[model samples]
Target: MTATGDADLSVVAAALGDRGRARMVLAVTDGRALPASTLAGEAGVSAATASAHLRRLVDAGVLRAEQHGRFRYFRLAGPEVADLVEALGRVSPPQPVRSLKEGTRAHALRLARACYDHVAGRLGVALTDALLDAGHLVGGDGADSGRRDGDRLPGLDVVDYSLSADGRTVLTGLDVAVPDAAPVRCCVDWTEQRHHVAGPLGRALLTTMTDRGWVRPARRSRALTVTDEGRTALVDALGLVWPPPHGPDRVPGERTALSRA
Candidate 1:
Protein backbone atom coordinates (compact mmCIF):
# COMPACT_ATOMS: atom_id res chain seq x y z
CA MET A 1 0.00 0.00 0.00
CA THR A 2 1.17 3.49 -0.80
CA ALA A 3 1.20 6.54 1.46
CA THR A 4 -2.30 7.35 0.31
CA GLY A 5 -3.51 3.92 1.31
CA ASP A 6 -1.76 4.19 4.64
CA ALA A 7 -3.36 7.57 5.23
CA ASP A 8 -6.75 6.15 4.38
CA LEU A 9 -6.30 3.33 6.87
CA SER A 10 -5.08 5.80 9.44
CA VAL A 11 -8.21 7.84 9.03
CA VAL A 12 -10.40 4.81 9.64
CA ALA A 13 -8.29 3.83 12.61
CA ALA A 14 -8.48 7.27 14.13
CA ALA A 15 -12.21 7.55 13.60
CA LEU A 16 -12.77 4.17 15.26
CA GLY A 17 -10.12 4.69 17.90
CA ASP A 18 -12.52 6.61 20.11
CA ARG A 19 -15.22 4.68 21.96
CA GLY A 20 -17.74 7.44 21.30
CA ARG A 21 -17.17 7.51 17.56
CA ALA A 22 -17.28 3.73 17.32
CA ARG A 23 -20.61 3.67 19.13
CA MET A 24 -21.91 6.25 16.72
CA VAL A 25 -20.86 4.05 13.84
CA LEU A 26 -22.59 1.03 15.36
CA ALA A 27 -25.74 3.03 16.07
CA VAL A 28 -26.27 3.84 12.43
CA THR A 29 -25.00 0.60 10.92
CA ASP A 30 -28.47 -0.95 11.04
CA GLY A 31 -29.50 1.03 7.95
CA ARG A 32 -31.09 3.84 9.90
CA ALA A 33 -29.62 7.17 8.91
CA LEU A 34 -29.66 9.32 12.01
CA PRO A 35 -28.98 12.97 12.62
CA ALA A 36 -25.91 14.10 14.49
CA SER A 37 -27.87 14.95 17.61
CA THR A 38 -29.27 11.44 17.86
CA LEU A 39 -25.87 9.95 17.22
CA ALA A 40 -24.29 12.17 19.84
CA GLY A 41 -26.53 10.72 22.52
CA GLU A 42 -25.81 7.16 21.38
CA ALA A 43 -22.10 7.90 21.38
CA GLY A 44 -22.30 9.71 24.72
CA VAL A 45 -20.51 12.72 23.39
CA SER A 46 -21.20 16.38 22.95
CA ALA A 47 -22.88 17.45 19.76
CA ALA A 48 -19.85 19.38 18.61
CA THR A 49 -17.59 16.47 19.42
CA ALA A 50 -19.79 13.93 17.68
CA SER A 51 -20.14 16.14 14.65
CA ALA A 52 -16.38 16.48 14.37
CA HIS A 53 -15.95 12.73 14.64
CA LEU A 54 -18.69 12.07 12.13
CA ARG A 55 -17.02 14.38 9.65
CA ARG A 56 -13.78 12.50 10.04
CA LEU A 57 -15.49 9.13 9.58
CA VAL A 58 -17.25 10.34 6.47
CA ASP A 59 -14.01 11.62 5.03
CA ALA A 60 -12.36 8.29 5.76
CA GLY A 61 -15.04 6.38 3.86
CA VAL A 62 -16.06 4.53 6.99
CA LEU A 63 -19.43 6.33 6.90
CA ARG A 64 -21.61 8.26 4.52
CA ALA A 65 -23.50 11.49 5.11
CA GLU A 66 -26.78 12.54 3.60
CA GLN A 67 -28.47 15.91 3.83
CA HIS A 68 -32.23 15.83 4.23
CA GLY A 69 -34.03 19.11 4.64
CA ARG A 70 -32.54 20.68 7.77
CA PHE A 71 -30.95 17.58 9.21
CA ARG A 72 -27.92 15.55 8.15
CA TYR A 73 -27.98 11.76 8.60
CA PHE A 74 -25.00 9.48 8.80
CA ARG A 75 -24.65 5.75 8.24
CA LEU A 76 -22.00 3.12 7.60
CA ALA A 77 -20.89 3.33 3.99
CA GLY A 78 -21.88 -0.26 3.25
CA PRO A 79 -22.13 -3.78 4.58
CA GLU A 80 -18.34 -4.03 4.54
CA VAL A 81 -18.12 -1.38 7.22
CA ALA A 82 -20.61 -3.30 9.32
CA ASP A 83 -18.44 -6.40 8.86
CA LEU A 84 -15.43 -4.52 10.17
CA VAL A 85 -17.38 -3.43 13.27
CA GLU A 86 -18.40 -7.04 13.95
CA ALA A 87 -14.85 -8.27 13.51
CA LEU A 88 -13.58 -5.74 16.01
CA GLY A 89 -16.33 -6.61 18.47
CA ARG A 90 -15.21 -10.25 18.55
CA VAL A 91 -11.79 -9.29 19.92
CA SER A 92 -12.79 -6.31 21.99
CA PRO A 93 -12.41 -6.80 25.71
CA PRO A 94 -15.64 -7.20 27.62
CA GLN A 95 -16.69 -4.24 29.69
CA PRO A 96 -17.21 -5.06 33.36
CA VAL A 97 -20.83 -5.65 34.39
CA ARG A 98 -21.53 -2.46 36.31
CA SER A 99 -24.73 -2.80 38.31
CA LEU A 100 -27.65 -5.19 38.66
CA LYS A 101 -29.77 -2.71 36.75
CA GLU A 102 -27.19 -2.38 34.05
CA GLY A 103 -26.67 -6.12 33.97
CA THR A 104 -30.39 -6.69 33.69
CA ARG A 105 -30.60 -4.23 30.86
CA ALA A 106 -27.71 -5.91 29.12
CA HIS A 107 -29.41 -9.26 29.50
CA ALA A 108 -32.61 -7.86 28.06
CA LEU A 109 -30.79 -6.33 25.12
CA ARG A 110 -29.09 -9.66 24.49
CA LEU A 111 -32.39 -11.47 24.74
CA ALA A 112 -34.44 -9.38 22.32
CA ARG A 113 -33.09 -6.11 21.00
CA ALA A 114 -31.17 -4.82 18.01
CA CYS A 115 -27.39 -4.96 17.86
CA TYR A 116 -26.51 -1.76 16.10
CA ASP A 117 -28.39 -2.49 12.88
CA HIS A 118 -29.41 -6.14 13.18
CA VAL A 119 -31.58 -8.30 15.36
CA ALA A 120 -29.90 -9.66 18.51
CA GLY A 121 -30.72 -10.71 22.06
CA ARG A 122 -32.59 -13.99 22.72
CA LEU A 123 -34.61 -13.44 19.61
CA GLY A 124 -31.48 -13.14 17.52
CA VAL A 125 -29.99 -16.23 19.08
CA ALA A 126 -33.16 -18.27 18.64
CA LEU A 127 -33.52 -17.16 15.05
CA THR A 128 -29.97 -18.21 14.24
CA ASP A 129 -30.61 -21.61 15.81
CA ALA A 130 -33.92 -21.99 14.04
CA LEU A 131 -32.28 -21.27 10.69
CA LEU A 132 -29.74 -24.00 11.22
CA ASP A 133 -32.31 -26.45 12.51
CA ALA A 134 -34.37 -25.82 9.42
CA GLY A 135 -31.39 -26.45 7.12
CA HIS A 136 -31.13 -22.83 6.10
CA LEU A 137 -27.55 -22.35 7.23
CA VAL A 138 -24.50 -24.61 7.18
CA GLY A 139 -20.86 -24.98 8.26
CA GLY A 140 -20.42 -24.40 11.97
CA ASP A 141 -19.04 -26.48 14.86
CA GLY A 142 -18.78 -30.30 14.80
CA ALA A 143 -22.43 -30.89 14.17
CA ASP A 144 -22.69 -33.12 11.10
CA SER A 145 -26.05 -31.83 9.97
CA GLY A 146 -24.95 -28.29 10.98
CA ARG A 147 -27.51 -28.39 13.72
CA ARG A 148 -26.43 -27.64 17.28
CA ASP A 149 -27.99 -29.28 20.29
CA GLY A 150 -30.45 -27.47 22.53
CA ASP A 151 -30.95 -23.76 22.22
CA ARG A 152 -27.35 -22.67 22.00
CA LEU A 153 -28.74 -19.22 22.72
CA PRO A 154 -26.94 -16.22 21.24
CA GLY A 155 -23.37 -15.09 21.99
CA LEU A 156 -22.03 -18.62 22.44
CA ASP A 157 -19.86 -18.26 19.29
CA VAL A 158 -19.27 -15.89 16.51
CA VAL A 159 -21.38 -17.90 14.09
CA ASP A 160 -20.65 -17.84 10.39
CA TYR A 161 -23.68 -18.69 8.24
CA SER A 162 -23.89 -19.39 4.55
CA LEU A 163 -27.21 -19.73 2.79
CA SER A 164 -28.09 -23.29 1.92
CA ALA A 165 -30.19 -24.37 -1.06
CA ASP A 166 -32.99 -24.98 1.36
CA GLY A 167 -32.35 -21.56 2.88
CA ARG A 168 -33.27 -19.86 -0.37
CA THR A 169 -36.39 -21.93 -0.69
CA VAL A 170 -37.38 -21.29 2.89
CA LEU A 171 -36.76 -17.56 2.67
CA THR A 172 -38.94 -17.40 -0.40
CA GLY A 173 -41.55 -19.48 1.31
CA LEU A 174 -41.46 -17.04 4.22
CA ASP A 175 -41.96 -14.23 1.71
CA VAL A 176 -38.53 -12.77 2.38
CA ALA A 177 -37.41 -11.11 -0.83
CA VAL A 178 -33.66 -11.35 -1.15
CA PRO A 179 -31.38 -9.82 -3.70
CA ASP A 180 -29.24 -11.57 -6.32
CA ALA A 181 -26.47 -12.25 -3.81
CA ALA A 182 -26.02 -15.77 -2.50
CA PRO A 183 -25.08 -16.30 1.14
CA VAL A 184 -25.23 -13.56 3.79
CA ARG A 185 -22.93 -12.76 6.71
CA CYS A 186 -23.57 -12.79 10.47
CA CYS A 187 -22.27 -10.37 13.12
CA VAL A 188 -21.63 -11.22 16.75
CA ASP A 189 -23.45 -8.93 19.16
CA TRP A 190 -21.27 -7.08 21.64
CA THR A 191 -23.95 -7.06 24.31
CA GLU A 192 -25.66 -10.40 23.66
CA GLN A 193 -22.38 -12.02 22.73
CA ARG A 194 -24.38 -13.97 20.11
CA HIS A 195 -24.46 -13.87 16.36
CA HIS A 196 -27.18 -12.01 14.50
CA VAL A 197 -27.89 -12.10 10.80
CA ALA A 198 -25.90 -9.37 9.00
CA GLY A 199 -24.23 -8.61 5.69
CA PRO A 200 -26.29 -8.28 2.52
CA LEU A 201 -28.73 -11.02 3.34
CA GLY A 202 -29.26 -9.74 6.85
CA ARG A 203 -29.85 -6.30 5.47
CA ALA A 204 -32.30 -7.69 2.97
CA LEU A 205 -34.27 -9.52 5.64
CA LEU A 206 -34.45 -6.40 7.77
CA THR A 207 -35.62 -4.40 4.83
CA THR A 208 -38.31 -6.92 4.06
CA MET A 209 -39.52 -6.97 7.65
CA THR A 210 -39.59 -3.20 7.96
CA ASP A 211 -41.31 -2.86 4.61
CA ARG A 212 -44.00 -5.31 5.61
CA GLY A 213 -44.58 -3.53 8.96
CA TRP A 214 -43.45 -6.59 10.89
CA VAL A 215 -40.89 -4.58 12.89
CA ARG A 216 -40.25 -0.95 13.65
CA PRO A 217 -37.84 1.34 15.46
CA ALA A 218 -38.38 2.49 19.00
CA ARG A 219 -38.63 6.17 19.69
CA ARG A 220 -35.33 7.95 20.33
CA SER A 221 -33.53 4.69 20.76
CA ARG A 222 -31.53 2.11 18.79
CA ALA A 223 -33.65 -0.81 19.93
CA LEU A 224 -36.33 -2.40 17.70
CA THR A 225 -39.75 -3.53 18.90
CA VAL A 226 -41.87 -6.29 17.45
CA THR A 227 -45.48 -5.53 16.59
CA ASP A 228 -48.71 -7.53 17.04
CA GLU A 229 -48.83 -8.21 13.35
CA GLY A 230 -45.13 -8.93 13.44
CA ARG A 231 -45.71 -11.55 16.10
CA THR A 232 -48.33 -13.20 13.97
CA ALA A 233 -46.10 -13.01 10.94
CA LEU A 234 -43.18 -14.58 12.78
CA VAL A 235 -45.30 -17.53 13.86
CA ASP A 236 -46.84 -17.90 10.45
CA ALA A 237 -43.74 -17.39 8.35
CA LEU A 238 -40.69 -18.16 10.49
CA GLY A 239 -42.27 -20.36 13.14
CA LEU A 240 -41.06 -17.99 15.88
CA VAL A 241 -43.05 -18.30 19.11
CA TRP A 242 -42.83 -15.29 21.38
CA PRO A 243 -44.01 -13.78 24.70
CA PRO A 244 -43.20 -16.94 26.58
CA PRO A 245 -45.09 -17.20 29.88
CA HIS A 246 -41.73 -17.08 31.56
CA GLY A 247 -39.08 -14.74 30.19
CA PRO A 248 -35.35 -15.31 30.00
CA ASP A 249 -32.95 -15.32 32.96
CA ARG A 250 -32.29 -11.64 32.38
CA VAL A 251 -34.37 -8.89 30.88
CA PRO A 252 -32.88 -5.57 29.86
CA GLY A 253 -34.66 -2.20 29.74
CA GLU A 254 -38.35 -1.41 29.86
CA ARG A 255 -40.52 -2.94 27.21
CA THR A 256 -41.58 -0.45 24.60
CA ALA A 257 -44.36 -0.83 22.09
CA LEU A 258 -43.40 -1.67 18.49
CA SER A 259 -43.82 0.92 15.76
CA ARG A 260 -43.76 1.06 11.96
CA ALA A 261 -42.16 3.87 9.95
Candidate 2:
Protein backbone atom coordinates (compact mmCIF):
# COMPACT_ATOMS: atom_id res chain seq x y z
CA MET A 1 0.00 0.00 0.00
CA THR A 2 1.09 3.55 -0.73
CA ALA A 3 1.05 6.73 1.42
CA THR A 4 -2.02 7.91 -0.51
CA GLY A 5 -3.78 4.61 0.35
CA ASP A 6 -2.96 5.10 4.05
CA ALA A 7 -4.49 8.61 3.90
CA ASP A 8 -7.61 7.22 2.21
CA LEU A 9 -7.94 4.60 4.95
CA SER A 10 -7.68 7.30 7.59
CA VAL A 11 -10.50 9.23 5.93
CA VAL A 12 -12.84 6.26 6.22
CA ALA A 13 -11.72 5.70 9.81
CA ALA A 14 -12.47 9.31 10.68
CA ALA A 15 -16.00 9.04 9.32
CA LEU A 16 -16.75 6.20 11.78
CA GLY A 17 -14.93 7.80 14.72
CA ASP A 18 -17.90 9.67 16.25
CA ARG A 19 -20.40 8.04 18.60
CA GLY A 20 -23.43 9.47 16.77
CA ARG A 21 -22.04 8.61 13.37
CA ALA A 22 -21.13 5.10 14.49
CA ARG A 23 -24.65 4.56 15.81
CA MET A 24 -26.11 5.75 12.53
CA VAL A 25 -23.84 3.38 10.61
CA LEU A 26 -24.80 0.42 12.78
CA ALA A 27 -28.53 1.23 12.41
CA VAL A 28 -28.29 0.41 8.72
CA THR A 29 -25.87 -2.51 9.08
CA ASP A 30 -28.73 -4.90 8.48
CA GLY A 31 -28.75 -3.72 4.85
CA ARG A 32 -31.73 -1.40 5.15
CA ALA A 33 -31.78 1.96 3.43
CA LEU A 34 -33.12 4.38 6.01
CA PRO A 35 -34.21 7.99 5.60
CA ALA A 36 -32.18 10.80 7.18
CA SER A 37 -34.92 11.55 9.71
CA THR A 38 -34.91 7.98 11.00
CA LEU A 39 -31.12 7.91 10.96
CA ALA A 40 -31.03 11.14 12.99
CA GLY A 41 -33.21 9.49 15.61
CA GLU A 42 -30.94 6.47 15.63
CA ALA A 43 -27.95 8.72 16.21
CA GLY A 44 -29.83 10.77 18.83
CA VAL A 45 -28.92 13.89 16.93
CA SER A 46 -30.75 16.87 15.54
CA ALA A 47 -31.67 16.77 11.87
CA ALA A 48 -29.03 19.39 10.95
CA THR A 49 -26.31 17.59 12.87
CA ALA A 50 -27.21 14.29 11.28
CA SER A 51 -27.15 15.86 7.85
CA ALA A 52 -23.57 17.00 8.39
CA HIS A 53 -22.55 13.58 9.72
CA LEU A 54 -24.21 11.82 6.82
CA ARG A 55 -22.49 14.14 4.39
CA ARG A 56 -19.13 13.36 5.93
CA LEU A 57 -19.79 9.63 5.76
CA VAL A 58 -20.86 9.96 2.14
CA ASP A 59 -17.81 12.04 1.26
CA ALA A 60 -15.57 9.44 2.91
CA GLY A 61 -17.23 6.70 0.81
CA VAL A 62 -18.41 4.85 3.89
CA LEU A 63 -22.05 5.36 3.01
CA ARG A 64 -24.07 6.25 -0.10
CA ALA A 65 -27.28 8.24 -0.49
CA GLU A 66 -30.08 7.41 -2.86
CA GLN A 67 -32.78 9.86 -3.85
CA HIS A 68 -36.06 8.07 -3.61
CA GLY A 69 -38.52 10.59 -5.00
CA ARG A 70 -38.76 13.39 -2.42
CA PHE A 71 -36.83 11.51 0.22
CA ARG A 72 -33.15 10.68 0.41
CA TYR A 73 -32.17 7.36 1.92
CA PHE A 74 -28.74 6.30 3.12
CA ARG A 75 -27.14 2.88 3.23
CA LEU A 76 -23.66 1.41 3.57
CA ALA A 77 -21.68 1.92 0.39
CA GLY A 78 -21.55 -1.87 -0.13
CA PRO A 79 -21.10 -5.21 1.57
CA GLU A 80 -17.46 -4.28 2.12
CA VAL A 81 -18.54 -1.44 4.41
CA ALA A 82 -20.72 -3.78 6.40
CA ASP A 83 -17.86 -6.25 6.63
CA LEU A 84 -15.58 -3.52 7.92
CA VAL A 85 -18.11 -2.56 10.59
CA GLU A 86 -18.49 -6.16 11.70
CA ALA A 87 -14.71 -6.54 11.89
CA LEU A 88 -14.49 -3.42 14.04
CA GLY A 89 -17.16 -4.74 16.40
CA ARG A 90 -15.08 -7.83 17.14
CA VAL A 91 -12.44 -5.68 18.83
CA SER A 92 -14.61 -2.85 20.19
CA PRO A 93 -15.56 -2.65 23.84
CA PRO A 94 -19.19 -2.93 24.86
CA GLN A 95 -20.89 0.38 25.58
CA PRO A 96 -21.97 0.81 29.17
CA VAL A 97 -25.72 0.52 29.74
CA ARG A 98 -26.87 3.74 31.41
CA SER A 99 -30.62 3.13 31.70
CA LEU A 100 -33.18 0.38 31.98
CA LYS A 101 -34.17 0.93 28.37
CA GLU A 102 -30.55 0.82 27.28
CA GLY A 103 -29.97 -2.33 29.29
CA THR A 104 -33.04 -3.99 27.81
CA ARG A 105 -32.08 -3.02 24.29
CA ALA A 106 -28.57 -4.21 24.84
CA HIS A 107 -29.68 -7.59 26.13
CA ALA A 108 -32.14 -7.94 23.29
CA LEU A 109 -29.46 -7.23 20.73
CA ARG A 110 -27.07 -9.74 22.30
CA LEU A 111 -29.82 -12.34 22.46
CA ALA A 112 -31.06 -12.06 18.89
CA ARG A 113 -30.33 -9.57 16.15
CA ALA A 114 -29.50 -9.28 12.49
CA CYS A 115 -25.92 -8.96 11.31
CA TYR A 116 -25.92 -7.71 7.75
CA ASP A 117 -29.06 -9.52 6.53
CA HIS A 118 -28.49 -12.73 8.54
CA VAL A 119 -29.46 -13.87 11.98
CA ALA A 120 -26.76 -13.10 14.55
CA GLY A 121 -26.20 -12.93 18.29
CA ARG A 122 -26.91 -15.96 20.46
CA LEU A 123 -29.68 -17.23 18.20
CA GLY A 124 -27.34 -17.24 15.21
CA VAL A 125 -24.54 -18.92 17.10
CA ALA A 126 -26.94 -21.55 18.39
CA LEU A 127 -28.27 -22.25 14.94
CA THR A 128 -24.76 -22.69 13.61
CA ASP A 129 -23.95 -25.02 16.47
CA ALA A 130 -27.11 -27.02 15.88
CA LEU A 131 -26.26 -27.43 12.21
CA LEU A 132 -22.76 -28.55 13.02
CA ASP A 133 -23.95 -31.04 15.60
CA ALA A 134 -26.38 -32.43 13.06
CA GLY A 135 -23.74 -32.83 10.37
CA HIS A 136 -25.63 -30.33 8.24
CA LEU A 137 -22.72 -27.89 8.09
CA VAL A 138 -19.03 -28.51 8.39
CA GLY A 139 -15.60 -27.00 9.06
CA GLY A 140 -15.76 -23.47 10.51
CA ASP A 141 -12.34 -23.45 12.16
CA GLY A 142 -10.82 -20.48 10.25
CA ALA A 143 -8.73 -22.77 8.10
CA ASP A 144 -8.52 -20.96 4.80
CA SER A 145 -7.11 -24.02 3.03
CA GLY A 146 -10.54 -25.64 3.29
CA ARG A 147 -12.40 -22.52 2.17
CA ARG A 148 -14.73 -22.95 -0.76
CA ASP A 149 -13.55 -19.82 -2.52
CA GLY A 150 -9.88 -20.23 -3.24
CA ASP A 151 -9.23 -16.69 -4.40
CA ARG A 152 -10.95 -14.96 -1.49
CA LEU A 153 -8.71 -13.37 1.10
CA PRO A 154 -8.52 -14.86 4.60
CA GLY A 155 -10.13 -11.82 6.16
CA LEU A 156 -11.49 -11.32 9.67
CA ASP A 157 -13.04 -14.49 11.10
CA VAL A 158 -13.06 -16.23 7.74
CA VAL A 159 -14.39 -19.66 8.64
CA ASP A 160 -14.32 -22.46 6.10
CA TYR A 161 -17.98 -23.43 6.30
CA SER A 162 -19.89 -25.52 3.81
CA LEU A 163 -23.25 -27.20 3.65
CA SER A 164 -23.57 -30.97 3.68
CA ALA A 165 -26.01 -33.13 1.72
CA ASP A 166 -28.18 -33.44 4.80
CA GLY A 167 -28.23 -29.64 5.04
CA ARG A 168 -29.88 -29.47 1.63
CA THR A 169 -32.50 -31.91 2.79
CA VAL A 170 -33.10 -29.92 5.94
CA LEU A 171 -33.63 -26.65 4.05
CA THR A 172 -35.85 -28.34 1.51
CA GLY A 173 -37.92 -29.79 4.32
CA LEU A 174 -38.27 -26.37 5.85
CA ASP A 175 -39.48 -25.03 2.49
CA VAL A 176 -36.58 -22.65 2.23
CA ALA A 177 -36.00 -22.34 -1.49
CA VAL A 178 -32.27 -22.62 -1.60
CA PRO A 179 -30.80 -20.20 -4.09
CA ASP A 180 -29.08 -21.80 -7.03
CA ALA A 181 -25.66 -23.00 -5.92
CA ALA A 182 -25.68 -20.73 -2.92
CA PRO A 183 -22.50 -20.75 -0.90
CA VAL A 184 -22.59 -21.62 2.80
CA ARG A 185 -20.21 -19.65 5.01
CA CYS A 186 -19.78 -18.71 8.64
CA CYS A 187 -18.97 -15.45 10.35
CA VAL A 188 -17.32 -15.29 13.75
CA ASP A 189 -19.96 -13.46 15.72
CA TRP A 190 -18.56 -10.38 17.39
CA THR A 191 -20.61 -10.68 20.56
CA GLU A 192 -20.70 -14.45 20.98
CA GLN A 193 -17.20 -15.01 19.71
CA ARG A 194 -18.61 -18.08 17.94
CA HIS A 195 -19.57 -18.99 14.42
CA HIS A 196 -22.87 -17.97 12.80
CA VAL A 197 -24.14 -18.77 9.37
CA ALA A 198 -23.34 -16.26 6.60
CA GLY A 199 -23.25 -15.94 2.81
CA PRO A 200 -26.18 -16.96 0.63
CA LEU A 201 -27.30 -19.79 2.91
CA GLY A 202 -27.58 -17.46 5.88
CA ARG A 203 -29.68 -14.96 3.95
CA ALA A 204 -32.03 -17.72 2.83
CA LEU A 205 -32.44 -18.99 6.38
CA LEU A 206 -33.26 -15.50 7.73
CA THR A 207 -35.78 -14.92 4.95
CA THR A 208 -37.43 -18.24 5.63
CA MET A 209 -37.66 -17.60 9.36
CA THR A 210 -39.16 -14.14 8.85
CA ASP A 211 -41.60 -15.37 6.20
CA ARG A 212 -42.79 -18.15 8.46
CA GLY A 213 -43.21 -15.76 11.37
CA TRP A 214 -40.62 -17.72 13.32
CA VAL A 215 -38.86 -14.48 14.16
CA ARG A 216 -40.01 -10.88 13.82
CA PRO A 217 -37.90 -7.75 13.75
CA ALA A 218 -38.23 -5.26 16.57
CA ARG A 219 -39.57 -1.83 15.70
CA ARG A 220 -36.80 0.63 14.79
CA SER A 221 -34.20 -1.93 15.82
CA ARG A 222 -32.49 -5.01 14.43
CA ALA A 223 -33.41 -7.24 17.38
CA LEU A 224 -35.70 -10.21 16.74
CA THR A 225 -38.14 -12.18 18.83
CA VAL A 226 -39.06 -15.82 18.36
CA THR A 227 -42.79 -16.47 18.17
CA ASP A 228 -44.54 -19.20 20.13
CA GLU A 229 -45.23 -21.22 17.02
CA GLY A 230 -41.66 -20.74 15.93
CA ARG A 231 -40.39 -22.03 19.21
CA THR A 232 -42.32 -25.27 18.77
CA ALA A 233 -41.45 -25.59 15.10
CA LEU A 234 -37.77 -25.04 15.62
CA VAL A 235 -37.62 -27.75 18.24
CA ASP A 236 -39.44 -30.25 16.04
CA ALA A 237 -37.47 -29.41 12.93
CA LEU A 238 -33.97 -28.69 14.18
CA GLY A 239 -33.99 -29.85 17.80
CA LEU A 240 -33.13 -26.29 18.79
CA VAL A 241 -34.59 -25.78 22.24
CA TRP A 242 -34.88 -22.07 22.81
CA PRO A 243 -34.85 -20.45 26.20
CA PRO A 244 -32.75 -23.43 27.07
CA PRO A 245 -33.29 -25.04 30.43
CA HIS A 246 -31.58 -23.11 33.20
CA GLY A 247 -28.84 -25.21 34.71
CA PRO A 248 -25.32 -24.87 36.02
CA ASP A 249 -23.97 -26.87 33.07
CA ARG A 250 -25.63 -24.81 30.38
CA VAL A 251 -23.27 -23.79 27.62
CA PRO A 252 -23.47 -20.88 25.28
CA GLY A 253 -24.53 -21.78 21.75
CA GLU A 254 -25.65 -25.20 22.96
CA ARG A 255 -28.63 -26.90 21.34
CA THR A 256 -30.46 -30.19 21.71
CA ALA A 257 -29.38 -33.18 19.67
CA LEU A 258 -30.68 -32.92 16.11
CA SER A 259 -34.06 -34.56 15.81
CA ARG A 260 -35.68 -34.77 12.41
CA ALA A 261 -39.40 -34.34 12.36
RMSD of 1: 7.6
- Candidate lDDT scores, in order, read 0.64, 0.78
Model 2, position 230: C-alpha lDDT score: 76
- Estimate TM-scores for all models: 0.68, 0.85
Q: Write the per-residue lDDT of candidate 1 for residues 116-136, one digit (tens) a residue.
A: 456755566455555655567
Model 1: lDDT to the true structure: 0.64
Model 1 clashing residue pairs (backbone): 30-117, 105-252, 108-252, 110-121, 111-121, 111-122, 155-193, 155-194
lDDT of 2 by residue, 163-193 (tens): 7888889988998776666457677677766
In model 2, what is the error at residue 155, expressed in angstroms?
5.8
Clashing pairs in 2: none
Model 2 clashes, total count: 0
